[model samples]
Target: MLIDASSVAASADEIRAGAVSGIIFDMDGTIIDSMPSHAQSWVAFVQNHGIDIDVPDLMRRTTGRTGAECMRELFARDMSDEEAWQHIAEKEQLYRELFAPIFTEVAGFKAFAAQTRARGLKVGVGTAGDRHNIAFAFGHLKLPTPPDAVAGGDEGLAGKPEPAIFLEVARRMAVPPERCIVFEDAPFGIEAARRAGMRAVAICTSHDAAQLAGPHVLAAARNYHELIESKFLERLHVEPA
Candidate 1:
């Protein structure tokens, strides 16, 4: 369901009144503008194996899923766990290679992360990317220090549209799900956040804002810069440092 801007504001107000204390972010599209690179890598990988799948369909089906899950879904065949891991590793290596030179964070993300930390809000990462991808991101991107907690797909957590990853992040951060707000770029991640009993803000990095809209979302922004400009974080009533 597409929510109007007024409804977004209302949801933000409601979340503020509810006392949000922590924030969880999804990595790929939410923190870094690497979706296109990722999609390109997927296309290259599949084509190399003589598989013919549309890039858009690949992205839509796999965005918030682990590489192993994505591989299985894309191939529509079962493989041994070892075989799955091998495919995941190779594909992610390709992703890292393709993404390294052009790596960039979402606009205003570094400053916003620092500010969120300064404001005493716990920060957590809930992502479907494996640890290698997470390491690559942190090692290459010009962002703030690592988040207080991280829950990745490699941890055996169920991927997005299922609440396990988000729930695990909230747990590791010592924040209750109800008091945590999630920042996500995919519809599946938004659904996962809501299912975990948290409010979500959509980062429209990969999809249009309207495509991301749903009842559980508080607002949608192109990047953290827009959120900051509009005082969206302030509306959460985070304490000053």
Candidate 2:
């Protein structure tokens, strides 16, 4: 069932039951501030391919999709799947190099994640980044658990706005989809959470506060700290009597 206000109300009962064991996080804009790095990589990669595209426009296209999907959209010309994959791989390699230096977390992200684990929540990463990007993120972030589970863009799972990736993460974590809480930064990711029957809190790291407001998100915050402070975490519990 898709997550709606009524569904979220129902899920709160599960959270208080301690049946909700998992926390799913989006990698790029939600966990780390890497969206700009991706935008830069797309601009440079496309330029090298003799295609001059606006970085912002390219970023919008690629926000919650796999690199191959972005390439297909940008090329506009028909390409065999293999050719598209090859081009995306090259572009992602460039993105890795560009993002290596600034592998910083969103404000309070590491602490909040650690705390969530301390509270006995299974932490999972659900991302549209491919294997290489996932590896790069872990290597740079250097966390304790390295995510209890991960679902990547190339994992044969459907990409964001489809809910497959998040649902897969919950499945891998042995948690039910309705019990998973998704932390996302993109509009597509929010829609995915709703489709997966999970409540989503938007982390507005890349977008302005006004831009992040929408129906798909239960709540919106500027960063991890704000999310925690706003008591959106209470959504993880049943409404007090």
* lDDT values for all models: 0.84, 0.76
Clashing pairs in 1: none
Q: Model 1 TM-score?
A: 0.93
lDDT per residue (tens digit) for residues 12-128 in model 2? 444354345778999998988888888888878878989877778767666888656776788987787688889988888888888887778888899889878777788899999
lDDT of 1 by residue, 116-144 (tens): 88778999999999999999998986455
Query: Candidate 1 local accuracy as lDDT?
Result: 0.84
RMSD of 2: 5.2
